[model samples]
Target: MTCKFILVTGFLGSGKTSLVKHMLSDWGESARVAVIQNEFAASGVDGKELKLANDQFELIEINNGSVFCVCLLGHFIHTLERLLDEYQPDYIVLEASGLADPINIVELLQADELSERLVLDQIITLVDAANIERSLAMLARTRHQIMIADVVLLNKQDCYPGDLTELSRLLRSMNPHAAIYPTEHGRICLSQLTESSHLAAGQYYGRQSADRPEQLSACVVRVHQRFTQENLNALLAELQHDCIRIKGFVQTPEDVTLSFHSVFENCQVAAVSSYSGAAELIAFSETLTSKQVRQIVRRYAS
Candidate 1:
């Protein structure tokens, strides 16, 4: 049977590795699987994560800056061909580097010889709930990632307490067709990734609404702070309507590094990662001005 390839991508620190690991666990014994990871670090992270399953699954690592560059396209094509010839697996999964532009990867697959061997199944993008709102406005890559995805998994959800109705409303306006799922630690049903067909040509990318021109200018900020429960709640409550999303990494008085994801009016919070770091907060909204955000930050900083 011809193989179906699912290209997975997300920004740095977005749990792409964890998501792939979980998916492998659920793939069952019936399906033959192969995975290709494109990484920026000299050390291959996915290889180590998938080591236990190495015997059963064919795994290959591409250590390059980003898969989107023409410099690495030749290597990607060569490695892909080699993997297919050796494994003949029923499914192929490619995880692109976080900073890598997914649209370019999709365009590469649409080209000559490579397109013949593998069919584009879906572009599954893992979004960092903590950083997405800000990243979406600041990075074109973020918006482009969402625009091309068949499935948008909003990961690291346990870390924010913002709003969901606004999130769904904004994302819907940005790309109406893609299914969006909120997940904690990248936990989501495998079916969400695979149970859909590739979107038709014209439907792959969608335009943001004119009213949300600010979404085109998304930005992210990470604040590392220890706060009283009331202070933490107050900080987030103030940000709920001010930006697209506010992901909070609050060090509660209880000695827990609490995380939360807020999209508009729907906010979900849970305790995640005990490792302490400055709280990372990402705020994004359509046409958000730097001055406006500075004010929001000052309000919380005080």
Candidate 2:
């Protein structure tokens, strides 16, 4: 039997992980689900979060680049093919990296290897209502994400209580076929996603370029020594302006491992060791070079 594939896309901190966790919880252990999580950097935070929420589903991670990129496409195909052969799950949820440009999604499903085994079930994209305007202005890929989605979740609605008439109109104009739902904290009934026989148009609009734009870049650094929470916060504050998303695990001076999730102006730090001894912290920024990232680390990490 062909496995149903759900492609979930959204910009950084749009809550894609929360939605996947919701689906896993709703489905329960009886459902055989496999999740493919892609991250622009080798920070194992998201994968760890998924396992913590529900360990029943098989989890796979493709990091350091988007699965759509030519550099990582070969490895992604190999990993996925092996997973399909080894564990035949009922559904496969692909959580794309925020920077991922899924313009070639239709072409990907039609690939000789995956076409028969995996069916394009639905393309669900989450939009951060509060930051939608800023994200759209910052990146063209954000618009492309909505254009190809079968189901578009205008997530983080509580963050923006103002009238969404204009925003909704703009989104509908991008993809008239997509069903847009206003959601808080990315929570929504699974039935709403698949109420129709066809959720997505399965077509990408505007620029069909598969190339990941050069502006966005990710830098990964190992946090070898423990630092004070204040120091970490300072580093986050300094980076948050240029870096859109900064996350990973950091050790405290008192030997406590804390997970950090920093998006734009907000930074959430928790004393949770979700990952397995992975101390690499990653920061994604627009137009920030690797050297600059290292410099910032050196200044604060001292």
Candidate 3:
């Protein structure tokens, strides 16, 4: 059977992960589903939290870069093809990195390589109701995410006690064609996850606005050597100023693999059994350059 593809896009802290988890729990019992979770950070925090039966669900974590970007588009295509050939899953869900532009992804799907094997099912964009106004004003990526969506989930309603009518009007103006649903913590009816005939049309691209300057950059570091805890701490300290999100796996001197995740001022490290020993870090500030990122990688990676 041809795999149905669902692309989930939203900005950081927008409850995309929570929505994916809910779908997995609710649907895993009945259908064979596969997931491709892409994150700007190298660590697989969201992938780890998605609980599904191994027999019926397959999860592929593409962390450290946006799959829609030039850096990882080839990798994304190869992995998607591999999943379809080997697993033959009933459905495939792509949880785009918070910084990803869903429009580029839709264009990629129209390419010959993926068009025949997989169908562009729907684009689900999750909007954080409480921060929508601020995000839309500050970030161009946020607007693009909303513009290409077939369904918009205006999530975090409980936290957003302010006027939603105005917010709804703003979202409607962005994509008058999209079906909007107001929800909290990304909770939505199970039917929304099911197949829909609303495949995104290719004509939308012609009318899209010109590309905007990218505010986010993903710098991936692959390390072969193990690091001491103190060494890792110092690296994170230096990155904290420029990076808003940091994640990936690190090997300690003792040969233990640990997952690393940092968002803003907060950081979390946990021991894990297996990892690629590669670090994918994302910096929000435009101040970060490729040269500086490579220097950091050269210092830490063996």
Candidate 4:
């Protein structure tokens, strides 16, 4: 059987991980799932959130860059081919990095490597209702994500509590063809996840990878020293900036590991009982360099 390919893309902190988790839990019951988790950071923090059945699903992580970028596209194709050959999964769900430019999806589906083996099932893009306005204004890729989606999920509705009618209208203006749905915590009906997108495979709009900018840069920051919850909050507060997004695991003074999630200047911290990775965060910024992040981390962490 040809593998069904579901590509999930969205901006940072847009509930992409939550949506993927929901899919894995709900869909894995019937279909064999293989997830391609492409993370911009070296640490696959988002992969940790997926609750998988050992026999029902498998995960492949392509980290440290966008899979759509020239930097990782070749590797991405090769990995998919290998997974299809060895695992023979029924569904291939790709959780692309927030910075990914998937405009070349049609070109990829038509590639000599994946054409016969894979079928494009759907292009689901999640829009963080609370942050969509700001993201649309500040990031070009945000518009691209919406423009190419077969189904657009206006997620985090509970957090927004604003005028979604207008928001929906704006999103429709971006892509009149896409089906739009309001969702909270990335919740959506199972049919939406399982149904074929009905989009013509070659119907992709002309916008391609050349339009994506390589302005964003990322680095992993590891802290061996433990911190009180208070210190950890203070440290993130000091470093929050308009150009950056951060997420990963943090070590507590009690030797516990806590998850950290930040978008722009806002963040949410929570304790996790199962985390085992080093207390390191992957930070991405449009203007900050790796050396600069390391210096800032040293100063604030000290």
Going through the candidates in the order shown, the clash numbers are 24, 2, 3, 0
Q: Residue by residue across 1-302, what tens digits does model 4's lDDT show?
A: 79989999999889998898877768756888899899877777787656421335788889877888877889989999999999999989999988877877878877799999999888999998888987888678788788888899999888886899999999989888788899988888769655535463245645466434557777777776676778778767866762467877777767778888887766889888766656777787777776777677666452
Q: Which residue ranges in model 1 land beyond 4 Å of their true spot?
A: 52-55, 200-302
Question: Each model's RMSD to truth, in Å?
Answer: 8.8, 2.1, 5.2, 2.3
Model 1 lDDT on a 0 to 1 scale:
0.66
| TM-score, ranked from best to worst | 2, 4, 3, 1
Shift in Å, residue 120, candidate 1:
1.2
Best by lDDT: 2
TM-score list, all predictions: 0.65, 0.92, 0.72, 0.92
lDDT of 3: 0.73
Error of 4 at 95 (Å): 0.5
Model 1, 17-106: lDDT tens per residue?
778888788886778989888765333434544654334688888864566666677788877778778888888888876556666555
After TM-score superposition, the amount by which residue 133's alpha carbon in candidate 3 deviates from its true location, in angstroms, is 2.1
Task: By lDDT, rank the candidates, best first.
Answer: 2, 4, 3, 1
Q: Write the per-residue lDDT of candidate 2 for residues 1-302, one digit (tens) a residue.
A: 89898899999889899899998998897779999999987665798878877898999988888898889888887877888899999999999999888877877777888989989888999998888888888888888888888889998887786788777898899888888899987789889988744534454433354567558888888878666889888988998988888888878777778888887786788887455666767888876777787778768763
Worst 10 residues of 1 by lDDT: 207-216
lDDT at position 104, candidate 3: 65
Candidate with the larger lDDT of 3 and 4? 4
